[model samples]
Target: MHQDPTENIVEILLSKSTVKQKAYRNVCRAFKELEQEAQLLIDVISAKTTERDQDIKLSVEPVSDQEFHIRIAGDLLVFVLHTNIISLPEDYEYNKSNYVADQPLRKYLGQINVYNFMADSFEFNRLNDPGYLLARLLINSENYFIVEGERQIGFMFKSISAKPLDKVDLDILIKLIISQAADNDLVVPPFPNIRKITVREKLEKTQSLGAGNKIGFQMSYQNETKS
Candidate 1:
């Protein structure tokens, strides 16, 4: 009853490939829905600002098939859908959860990364400025999703068994992301880090300054709320 090695390899490949395909499709669908939701949120915010005669710049721009950018005031949130599917590490918390344990195939997921950057970085063409990863959205073949992020974003959407991702969920997520980004303000770099700069650095202020919301601070997930 020994299985042929070639046949076994082919069978495993076929099964995993199918799972990857499904996960990719689900991520793509979620990305499209997110783009639409983001635009809707921007419109609502814009309307309110207009009502109050306030100038709050807000817009959503699709950068590519896999990426989009949402500008809310001084912060820019970039959403990028990864083309590849991935499996959770063995020790990852999701792997230990009953959701994935019940169906091991659920471990395979596609990812969409959310990054926060200072709008001035792109506006002023500061190529060396850094962008912080605010959250990662993981979607499985079944569209069951989880968000790994800072603060409320990390804890609020931990459940994978609740339901498939939807417009309402996206709206909530977009608001949380914008709130987190806006709450974290840019701070000056420590004296030691910027005290000793070369003459060349003085000439290239934009690149050498390395501006970021948490430029000289600890950016660990556990330390996010502390700041």
Candidate 2:
């Protein structure tokens, strides 16, 4: 006997919806854990640095239900959780891994993105300043997680874990992110690029002048191509 098409559609919808709901819930729990861990870490750092340089500032600010900011001295790291649950593409390396092969639902993920920006950008209200994407954490319904990120964060966390990320794991991840952001120094823009600003720009958008760690790399690449 053939099954009814309507019933098959409903079954598929319900199954997928259930998986997505579970993934969303897992991500929300993970995010809350991350926020708590970050706050605790900040407190520890504050206590340790009490006698250190007075200029060094550290704080965590919750921006919203799905976002927060961690300010460490000259750097600002923004963490944003995507509201949607998504599945990795079939060709994605992680999707092909044995971890996901064992259970296809593990491929579904909720993403949390981390961005790095200069603290001065926000302080000076430089809306035009660029922020770099430092890392993204992907968590599945079972709480298994992985990170795709820059520098050490990339290589160190390329593989998906069999277990959920715990407090220790989160602490290490946060420390690494802070280290990466602190180490990435801002560079002066190329002289030619900044030498020809109009009077209006100098008066109005002076603070908006592009500033970032890798700001000049693209311009230099373009110059090289033209040459």
Candidate 3:
């Protein structure tokens, strides 16, 4: 008995969608694991480096279903996981020169983007600040991925065709990337025209009754001060 062409097409579509959904879930799992480990690493750094008055903080926040942020030191690293599966173009260098599993004509991938966020952009809730890509993950399988980004991260996996996320080496690589990101200072003095001065009143006690101390307030500008 011949199956209906329409039914066959429907089955194919459902199968493809199922594969993509599975891929998305896998990417999410990998991301969650990475987040947990990375957060722990940052906590260790904070415990080691924080001072009496100045505390070093590292935070992780989920901005959306597909996006989250890792705030390390004073900078923010945004991680965005794309839900849609994508295929490499035929002319792409990897497609042409790399070793593929040889199972399918088109290789589908789930993508994860790592972005740098200026402190003010995230803290102040400003949308105008532009972020640049710090790293990217092309996730084909739950455990296998290709990384592309800055030298600090991209160099770790340069020799391998694809890296396994579950490997111990990946944890080390992630730690290195986070440390490098923390060292990458993104904060700077705001523009002179846009900067503002904040004034706070300070109460001072009279010195030894005879020697009077002039009570004055403190005026602090961003990274600057004038009495």
Candidate 4:
């Protein structure tokens, strides 16, 4: 366990290439608001004391009274990056819900399941993530209310209170995600719902438009303040 929890997170998310890294990056980018709302602790302890693994798991228990439950699991070569911890060693085979006896493929299936368990957390996190500004703008338009012909359908849309998320916004919330991908490329996974989906399309849009490394206004301001 690293002395500073965020440092352990940063090390694993930024340096490690194992399976768990992807989920960690998403949690960081998508759940930054939770940095304030939730208490995040870094703990290293044995699991299977054993429905899961002899590995690492991220255990997410809700507060005394709350709206969410988040847990991420770790495997032999990976550390769970969410709330509940689940780590099992290799060569120990049980009936995974998505099992086909292909361990690597099956592991990912389980990984994705563990990934989805906290879907609500990520969705709530989305109201604060990048594309969310756009989603919110759409929601807020007086035009935000759309009437197709006679029946009310959905909301119409307009624009941001500002110029919309430009390069800097993309850098802070979007590319930071891409920079940590396994292939080191910005991408969107195939899941359709924003909550279920990884922000790969946003990655493509930013890269295509020539957005790359940059800093957030908040971080930049802090740096200047220090200097």
Candidate 5:
């Protein structure tokens, strides 16, 4: 009797890893919910602030399946939804009873990350623009989440187990993002010379743009003429 060489391949392809599938579902659901919540908040804030003489405009753009951009008061807050599994440190405080499973455990965490950058950074595609991680939603191996950084958010979920994100959780997450964005100190704009250099380079490269905006010499780049 000859064994089919493709038997193992077929079995492997058909094999279902229920735990991973569930984790992936959890991540996707949470991100989608968060996206919806953020949009609603933007609408509410825009409506309430529209009557002011000079209202700050907030814009949310979807960068990718796992990423979003929120512009508030000249700051760009990038919220990234990561689907990769993560693990908590052994030292992390949690009740083992919450994650009792038959199989040997592994730490798999998912993350919802927030980063702050200058509004013009994304506008000009500056890869090196200054930014920092304001917060993270960590989904532990047991499909529970614990938020890191941003005390307000951490405190919100401190008592709860890391479970799939729901409407309430999404709402709070959006609020936390807005809260961080409202704190102007979090985002540091690029140096004045940096902006000038970037604008100068763009003007030099694009012929359609007039030279009137050029700043004479590029302060960031050195010119060398070899003999």
Candidate 6:
């Protein structure tokens, strides 16, 4: 019988041995596959939603987080997530500037519910929409982040998951997390910047993007040793 890889993952974590490394590699491999699936999904969904672009009239600068802040040419749109969620820095401001009093980053980043999005949508829509599915890169991976076009948008995980402790905390929680064994299916490698490769590896392999925009992140993997 095929056991859940997550069980193997937890055991590997619990056991300090070479098997753990192999398990970690397996986890990364799994995330990489999921990431690809997510991209395909974006392409498919975007094609369907393009026809409704009458209200979408903002410059797409291909900004960080794969998000682009829209001026709407000439109109006022009080922005919020698909949910009755409040605004984040990325949700508003024309550029990347903190908005919540002195908090700087206090944006709400909700998951991109594909099921809900297909049913409901913001009147004005474009590539860099204000939902999870719109902004996150490596969505199914641990390195996943809430992509935002505007700095006005705060971190999204804070509300759905919990509040950020600091920049460090902000960074950690933003990406994919392992709440349980199944979540390991999406957990990214090295957990953080720590890695089998160095920062240079990241710069070389990864396309760096700004605060709210997204750049692709290819999770790394080690080969499982054959017994």
How do the residues 1-227 of candidate 3 rate in per-residue lDDT, one tens digit apiece? Answer: 97669988998898777767766776787777777777776677667667553556667777777877877755677888787888766665445443444434225667787777665555655544556667777666444666665556655655223445673655775676676676665334446732443332111211111111111122111111111
How high is each candidate's TM-score? Answer: 0.86, 0.88, 0.69, 0.16, 0.67, 0.22
Candidate 4 per-residue lDDT, tens place, 152-182, comes to 1111111111332222332232212212221
Better of 5 and 6 by TM-score: 5
For all candidates in order, the CA lDDT equals: 0.80, 0.78, 0.60, 0.25, 0.61, 0.29
**Candidate 6 per-residue lDDT over residues 138-158, each given as its tens digit:** 111122223332121223332
Score residue 84 of candidate 4 by CA lDDT.
Answer: 26
Model 4 stretches astray by more than 4 angstroms:
1-46, 49-55, 68-200, 204-227
Q: What pairs collide in candidate 5?
A: 85-109, 86-108, 86-109, 144-162, 145-162
Runs of candidate 3 with Cα error greater than 4 angstroms are 1-15, 51-53, 159-163, 167-170, 185-227
TM-score for candidate 5, residues paired by index: 0.67
Expressed as tens digits, the lDDT of each residue in 26-93 for candidate 2 is: 88888888888889988888788877776688999999999999999888899999999988667777
Candidate 4, residue 22: lDDT? 41
Model 2 ranges off by over 4 Å: 1-3, 208-227
Cα RMSD for candidate 5?
Answer: 12.4
Q: Score candidate 1 by TM-score against the native.
A: 0.86
Candidate 1 lDDT by residue in tens digits, 1-227: 97669988899899889988998999999899999988988898889888876767789999999999999888889999999899877876677777777778888999999888888888977777788888888899888787777677866775563788888888899888878887878887777787687777767764436464532222222211100
Of 2 and 5, the candidate ranking higher by TM-score: 2
Q: Which 10 residues in a row give candidate 2 its minimum summed lDDT?
A: 218-227
| Candidates by TM-score, descending order | 2, 1, 3, 5, 6, 4
- Provide the lDDT at 221 for model 2: 8
**Leading candidate by lDDT:** 1
